[model samples]
Target: MRCRYPPGMPFYAYILLCNDGSYYVGHTDDLDFRLGQHQAGALGGYTAKRLPVKLVWSESFPTRDEAFAAERRIKGWSRAKKEALIAGDWELVSRLARNRQGA
Candidate 1:
């Protein structure tokens, strides 16, 4: 079932800095509620044990599928790519993107 937030807001692709200095990425329609669940350990998964996570970055999408797709793509990215994305270093991300194409 789809998340029921407003009528036509957007889904959020979010990244969190875990307490262990790692990162977690996910997508949800309600950013605040989802982040709260992660922080409260209510999700009972990776982020749950990695409590005290802080919201580091987020991107909005027109649909939940788009947000989830982006989250999945980012989840497979290298540390450098993730860092670059977190830092809003579009140039670095673009470089990494080009490198992935072996160009």
Candidate 2:
């Protein structure tokens, strides 16, 4: 069975601040459920072992593809870039990306 999102559903690109001071990036249409899963360790894997995860950042998109693309992009970013993003510092993120380029 295929489950389709309702009309006007919003998808999200989210970053979690793990207990060990690392970030986890992911996309979901249902943010609350996904967060709950991570918090309870039901999701398993990276966040499960880290435990005590907190919702650090998130951006909403009208479509799942946009949210997914954002997630993938963030996943490739360096810690500095991710921190810049979490701080909502677009200038810093661009600077970091450029500095890391061609290296």
Candidate 3:
């Protein structure tokens, strides 16, 4: 808890790179602790067997709901979309944005 997060915050959005080259998206109030759990095989549910995960990306949020929303959206995204987010490519993100306005 050395992290100086403002009090009352409850979640974060994070990405983990599995040993199989697949990416896992998730959200947690304590990123460090959660990562440790995954690495220790204690939280080995999804990332458990997919051990040796590396922290690839993370974003902190003030609320669990927001973080959960982000995690859900990212989980459904294609690999290219995930890569674009990792590369910080706003252009690519926009180009790949799904057409929701089914007009």
Candidate 4:
């Protein structure tokens, strides 16, 4: 069998655009398989109720630690920040953070 991951490989941090127009953030070692689970309602959580989730964003890290950290960080982000991320608007994200800091 082909190896899905080599030793010491990085994991992935991903964002899903749910049918409810909300976003979900998560981390996984196998992105395709994890996404499949969410799609099939195997995960049976947030994405389950909001099926038909589409992968809108993903970033790989050198380690699961980094991916997990990113997931937690993004989960704390506002909808605008997450939308900025999905839109690849780094400047908007930065501006939002700066505004948040000033508030």
> Which stretches of model 3 miss by more than 4 angstroms?
1-10, 98-103
TM-score against native, each model: 0.90, 0.92, 0.85, 0.91
Give the lDDT ranking, best first.
Answer: 2, 4, 1, 3
Q: On residues 7-98, what C-alpha lDDT tens digit does candidate 2 reach at each position?
A: 68999999999999999999999999999999999989999999999999999999999999999999999999999999999999989988
For each candidate, what is the lDDT?
A: 0.92, 0.95, 0.86, 0.94
In candidate 3, what are the lDDT values of residues 1-103, reduced to their tens digit? 4656566877889999999899999999889999999899897578988889999989888878899999998998889989889888978877777543332
Model 3 TM-score on a 0 to 1 scale: 0.85
Candidate 3 deviation (Cα RMSD): 4.5
- Two-way TM-score contest, 2 vs 3, winner: 2
Indicate the residue-level lDDT of 27 in model 4: 100
- How far off is residue 60 in model 1, in Å? 0.9
Q: Which stretches of candidate 2 lie over 4 Å from their true place?
A: 1-3
Per-model root-mean-square deviation over C-alphas: 2.2, 2.0, 4.5, 3.7
